[model samples]
Target: MLRLLYVMTLTVCCLPLIPGLGGVLLSAASYLPALGLNEPNLDGWHAMTSWPGSGTALQLSLFTGVTATLLAILMTFLILQRCWGTQGWNRIEKWLSPLLAMPHVAFAIGFALTFSPSGWLFRLFAALTGETEPYLWSLVQDSQGFGLILALAIKETPFLLLMSLSVLKQMQVDRLLTASRSLGYNASASWLKVVFPQWLTKMRFPIYAVLAYGMSVVDVAMILGPSSPSTFAVLVWQWFNDPDLTQVPRAAAGAIALFVACFGVLLLYRLAEYFLVKGWQSWQFSGSKTYSLPGKYLFGFVALLPVIIIPVLLVWSFALRWRFPSLWPTRTTTRFWEQEVGNLLELAANSLILGLVSASVALVFAIGCLEYRDKYHKSVPQLVIAIPMLIPQLSILFGIQIAIYMLPGQWHVPATIWAHILFAFPYVYLALDGPWHSFDQRLTQTARSLGHSAWKAWVSVKLPIVLPAILLAWAVGLSVSFAQYLPTQLLGAGRITTLTTEAVSLASGQDRRISAIYGLIQAFLPLVFFGIALAASRIADPQRRLARHADKQVSSNELISTKPNH
Candidate 1:
């Protein structure tokens, strides 16, 4: 039965890649029979490549993606080097959950509100300088996409930090740092020389995830990215939404091109990582000198950006009459809330239901796969499992959307939920991987020896031991589902509206009030689930005494290793 379920899990989560890719490839090659383009040819590819500003858009995507990823990585490393074992580290950890909770769209919305020429920052500057002139430069929708790059970098840093937590814990960073420092190296130099290479290698997937997102981010790019050329992903999105039916093949080709560009960028990043760590060693061994970074200040700014953005969102949601150069709203009203509250409840209900159902289903599938791997000592490779994550959503989603169109009856909700599950499963699997690997098998073995069946033993013995991780993984899946924009939009065909789709739609309307209300709600929902997960983890443990002790011991060892050597 377990083996059967494992097969089912793969069928549901992994099999779609076949049809998704095949469908897109077929369409890109102008082989879609239904549209009367039966001959396989390069016309679609020609159309896509020949489009105006196509090269510029592709360049923007590459530039913004690479720059943002590099900046986020550097920022993450600096924060870790400065605060890993100190009391400041606690604050960093505390800030991570909320920072991570803010969806990319919400962050982009808030970022636009805060940094745009007529935005609050300009108003504050005007108030200080008493100059009525609008700012000369535009960050939001600028031609260069610098704003998009900055926003992506700032938003992704916390995620990389979160991914690093397990790596650092598992790597025994404390001992390595201590050993390096004892060899007459300073703490910073020791970390730079010894720990960074390992951290970079282990952090490859998270960084790739960040890079993929940076390259193909549609909603956020739509909100804050340059408009003249737009990014490549946004260009593909526009092409897909074009009213002309013949243009869709071009869109399909564009999606394929975007996927190729993203894959190429990932490959480039891998090569850079190889050279920095494996292919090049002079930088590591020759480095006894390390310069101090303003990590505390940098971290403070990164953490505070979201904090500031949220309140601005709240104020905008309630503001009735607010003009430029005014520090606060002249008159605030809840009309937006009043008008949206009814629709908000419906959207929230839909979002909540979708998130819960998809996340729950994905969690079960992930656990089944993990258990299958453990039992058989053979399973799908990590790369196969991560296909959904590594591939650009725009690439496969177009094909998946077409496949859903062939299904009979109403499938918007199911198709949307299924799409959510497809994306959410990998995150849930990753969250559970560490815990499942670290879990003790003896507990289950002992239960089995006591005449308990495998299922019974798993239920009574293994389940309780990993309940916290399970709950957390469920929440992670929930969050991933909640944050989805493309899948919800494309698969639902705009008929089904979730908070993310709603937020992105409203953002284009340029109504700050309505956008903030949706953005706040979008960000708030997953946080509630995360809070519940944390509370449940504590409650389920009854006595988290051992966990607390282990954490303290880890922190103490880190602190001792990081202390300055006279």
Candidate 2:
């Protein structure tokens, strides 16, 4: 049964890549049976490269992706250097989950709300200057994509910071810091000289994920990116949506091109890491000239954004009248919420259903794979599992969509759910990786020895211990599914709508109140689940039991030492 289950898990998580890539290659080659163009040709590729502004779009993607990734990495490292072990770190941890849970769509919207020409900041500036009009200067939809880069950088920082936690713990950062300080290295120098390299190495996959995400991000780019050419991925998405059947091949070719771009960038990043960290030993031992980042303030600002954005969205959602240069809405009501209450409930239900189903299924598949590895002494590799996350969604989904059309029956809903699972599985598996490895197998062995079956032993012993991590992983999966915009948009065939899809769609519309309502709700649902997970994890944590056990042991040992006989 375990072997069978493992095979099923592999089928779900790994095997799809074959058909996905195959279908894409075929479509890119102009072998489209549905379009009656079964002959292989390179016309699609020709059209894609020759498309006006394709060069500019490609440059935008690369520049924005690489730059944002670098900034996020730098910010994450500096934040760690300044506050990883400090009291401020505790507060940062409290903020990480919700901040991490804020979807890119919502983040982009909030960013625009705060920084656009007619946004709140401009309003404030106009008010202070005694001007009746908003400023013409803006960040959103800039021709240079600075806004896109900024949003991507800030959004990815929290993720890198969270991943840094596990890496930092494993590196025993405190001891490293202590040794570095003894050698005359200051706090900044110690972190830079001692911790940054290790953190970078350990965070390679996450960095890759972020890079791919930044490069392929569609909704966020649409919200804040330039309109002239937009990002390459967005262009491909638009191409795929073209009503002309002949454009499908060109779109497929673009997807393949995007895949190549992501693959090349990831490879380049790997080589860079190798050269910077491993190929040269000089940098590791180089003089520790320290420079402090304004990390405390920077992180405070980054962490405080959601606190501000949420209220702004809330205020906009309820605003009946709010003019430029006014700090507060003149009037507010629940009319907007009330008007959309039914639609809101339906969207919420769809989102909840998708999140619950995908997260639960992904969690089970993750558990199965882990168990199979333990029982059979074999498993798929981490990279294979993470392929879904590392590759551009546009690339894989294009081919997957082709495959769906090849099928005679309705595959949209099933395919979307499967895509969500495939993407979320990597996170789920990695989340459980530490816990499952650290889990004491002896308890299970003891249970098995005392007349329990393997399954029974696992259920009675292993499950309880990892329950906290399991819940946490589930919460991660839920957020992942909730934040899915591309999969739902592409695979749902416009027949399905979730809060993420609606939020992204509304972001493009002129209705800020409606957009804010959706964005706020979209942010709220995932946060609720995450809050529950954290609270439940705390309640169920095995550490509490172990700590209590240690306290009793300490008391008994002290009592024995101070006995009257002594």
Candidate 3:
């Protein structure tokens, strides 16, 4: 039964990658039989490449993606090196949940609200200087894509920090710092020389995820990215949405190009990582001098940026009439909320149903895969499982859409939910991996020894111990599903209306009130699940005292050993 379940899990979670990739490949080669283009040819690639501004679009993607990733990585390392063991670390960690809870779309909306020429910043400048002339330069939709890059960098920093948590915990950074400091190196010097290389190496996967996201992000890029040429991902999305049927192959080819570009960027990142850490070892040993980072201020800025963003969203949602140069909404009303309340409920329901169903299904598959690994001592490789994550969604989504088109039924909900599950499973699996691996098998053995069946032992003993992690994993999956825009938009065929899709669509209208309403709801849905997960984790953990004490001890050890004289 377990083996059968494992097979089923793989079918549900992993097998889709095959059809997804194949469909995209065939369509890219202009061999889609459904569209009456049975013969394989390079016309699709030729058309995609020959499209005006295609090169510029690709350049935009590369520039914004690489710049954002490098900036986020640099910020993450600086925060870790300077503040990991300090009291400020607690504050940073506390802020991580909320910062992470804000979806990319919501953050993009808020960022535009704060940074756009007519946004609050300009209003403040106008009010202070009495310069009523409208500003010409704009960060939102800037030609160079700097706004998009900044938004992606700021949004991804917290995620990189969150990803760093487990990596840092595993690195035993305190010991490294202690050992290095004993050799007459300052705390900053020790961290730079001793801890950075290993941390960077371990951070490869997270960095890949970040880079892929930056390159392939459509919704966020749409909100904040330049539209004249747009990023390649956005261009591919536009092509996919083209009403002309013949353009389908062009879209497919663009998707393939995007996948290749992202894959190339990932390799470049890996090579850069190797060169920085391994090829440049002289920097590690040649210097006792180390530069101090303003980590506290950086962290404070990153944390408080969201705090400011959320409130602006709220204010905009309620404002009925607000002119430029007004610091606060001059006259506020709930008219937008009143008008949207009915549709909001339905949108929320669709989002809720999809999120719950997909996340639950993904969680089950993840659990089954983890159990299979434990029982059989073999499992699918991590890279295989993470293919959905590391690959650009636009690439395979075209293929998945083609597969769905061949199915003989209404597939909007199922296809969307399936896509959500495909993407969500890897995160669920990763979230549960640590807890499942660290679980004490002795408890299950003891239960079995006491006349329990294998199933009974797992249900009664192992399940309870890991239930908190499981809940958190479910929440993570739920969040991933809720935040998804591309999968839902493409697979649902515009029949399924969710907060994310609505938010992205409304953003183009440039209605702050409407955009705020959708963005707030979009951001709120994930926080609901995250809150439940946090509460459940606290409720499920019986050894709160021990856990708290262990955390304290770890913090103390890190502080004592790695505390820098700043």
The 10 consecutive residues of candidate 2 with the worst lDDT sum are 287-296
State TM-scores per candidate. Answer: 0.93, 0.93, 0.92
Quote the positional error of residue 555 for candidate 2 in Å.
15
Ranking by TM-score: 2, 1, 3
Local accuracy of candidate 3 as per-residue lDDT tens digits, 216-255:
9999999999999999999999999899887788999999
Positional deviation of residue 494's Cα in model 1 after best superposition, in angstroms = 1.7
Q: 49-155 in candidate 2: lDDT tens per residue?
A: 99999989999999999999999998888788888877888999888888977877787778888888878878878888898877776889998898889888888
Error of 3 at 282 (Å): 1.9
Tell me, what's the RMSD of every candidate?
6.8, 3.6, 6.9
lDDT of prediction 2: 0.87
Model 3 scores a TM of 0.92
> Worst lDDT window (10 residues) for model 3?
287-296
Misplaced by over 4 Å in model 1 are: 289-291, 446-457, 545-566
lDDT, each prediction = 0.88, 0.87, 0.86
Best-performing candidate as measured by lDDT:
1
